[model samples]
Target: MVSSAAQTPSSSVEQARQEGALQTALALNRLLNPFKIEVKVLGSTAHLRGEVENEVERQLAERVALATRGIETVQNDLKVNAELIEQPLERRAYAQRLEDATLASIIRARLLWSTHTQAASIEVDSREGVVTLRGQVSSAEAKELAGVLASSTEGVYLVNNLISLSAADMARLREEHQELIADPPLSDAWINDKVQTSFLYSRNLDGPNIKVATQDGVVRLSGEVVSSEQKTIAVEVARQIRGVRGVDADMLKVATKVSG
Candidate 1:
């Protein structure tokens, strides 16, 4: 999840510094392109290692890493394979496309399981090594966290975060969340409709693969999800629905090896 920049080190100066550096490293992950990027932060400087598609991607990685809060310098040691540079354009493009698609899937799954962001509301798309995030996010912290997650994905060259806030009125949203806890929304029927709708629209959820049933404001999730992450997200989404008194996931089935 996203948060405001760590304050200038105070009494916990050393601790803050360490955390800031780690955060900066995590933010740089989205710049990776088909190769694992390792980040090591030392004070205000970050060391970047691993392989990249080309000099351009390597430079882009460093630039993006520098933009992350709490880092001023980047020590780039990203190596570019010369053999790939000589390959035909179509071949290179095909390889990149395949890698990008895989990267997008992994990133989307991670976001779904993230505690800091609303995975259902965020959409991940990748093309030509650039990742784009679109859809609605509830809070600014989630928005920032989404971007950072995209940056850290494998084979991601550039990230364009365009997830807008769904709620323009944060105060109203906070009140609604509070009110739902105190006095659920409407009735069981209303809650069921909203819960099912949320699942149908989620980016990471396999909607058709799962079933939703509600009675007396109790949500019961059944059927199968591709991953444990999806199962977790499904439960969280149901709970977030207004008027949900309780959620029963015991009936929900998760496959150990889901492939489609």
Candidate 2:
């Protein structure tokens, strides 16, 4: 029920993905300023039309689009106000650290504005080019999203996410974790069968030693592997399979028989 490459969008599958990409970009924007914008979707490409204050904001839009899972290319049609104040990158090499600090501030400001993040509790640090995020977040997804935001910021070269849940949140997380492990929705026997077959077909793995299970959309890989490398590969295979929302590899162990 899909069209060929040369065909029109007889189906809106690609269109939907493009729309999703646009929504992600808008969410990331947080609209700190009054600069109006428009988004257009063309196949796997994201077209951005807007006016921003400076080059940083201009590039921020492209970065957000590129970070989106479905967007392959971003066309930034953003106009920056020529009179706007911006850190002149053409300054001497000594100003490099200052630029990094500005990028960090931009990241922190965005985090504070995002509805999905707890920016006040999180500590942001930028040294040279790397940004380190510390403090507590509500969940694993929030932690990951924070890292994504930091890394996608214009000047960040590296990210160290040290955020964890608070004690109260941890308690709540445990209850959710228990339910998640106990039940998996949108998952069924077919996905389980596919996961097992994927391992069996993998040239690098021994599927017989790895047991695969699926619930809802979560995939669990248990049993044992001959080496740590094989264990990692097995987990990755399960993660790549369709219908898998999360992966549980807690029970997977590397065999003692294998030498380090």
lDDT of 1 at 22: 52
Model 1 per-residue lDDT tens digits across residues 62-104: 7777876777877888788756544445655555666667678
Question: Where does the lowest 10-residue lDDT sum fall in candidate 1?
Answer: 1-10
Writing each residue's lDDT as its tens digit, candidate 2 over 1-260 gives 22346546553666776676566556444331334557776666778886677787888888877877777898889898755434333332334555556667766765653334523367888887688998776678778877766775555689999988887876665665466446544446867886786576455778888998888868888998889898887776676554567789999988887458
Off by over 4 Å in 1: 1-184, 256-260
In candidate 1, position 243 carries an lDDT of: 62
Highest TM-score: give the candidate number. 1
Q: What is candidate 1's CA lDDT for residue 129?
A: 62
What is candidate 1's CA lDDT for residue 141? 76
Estimate the TM-score for candidate 2.
0.33
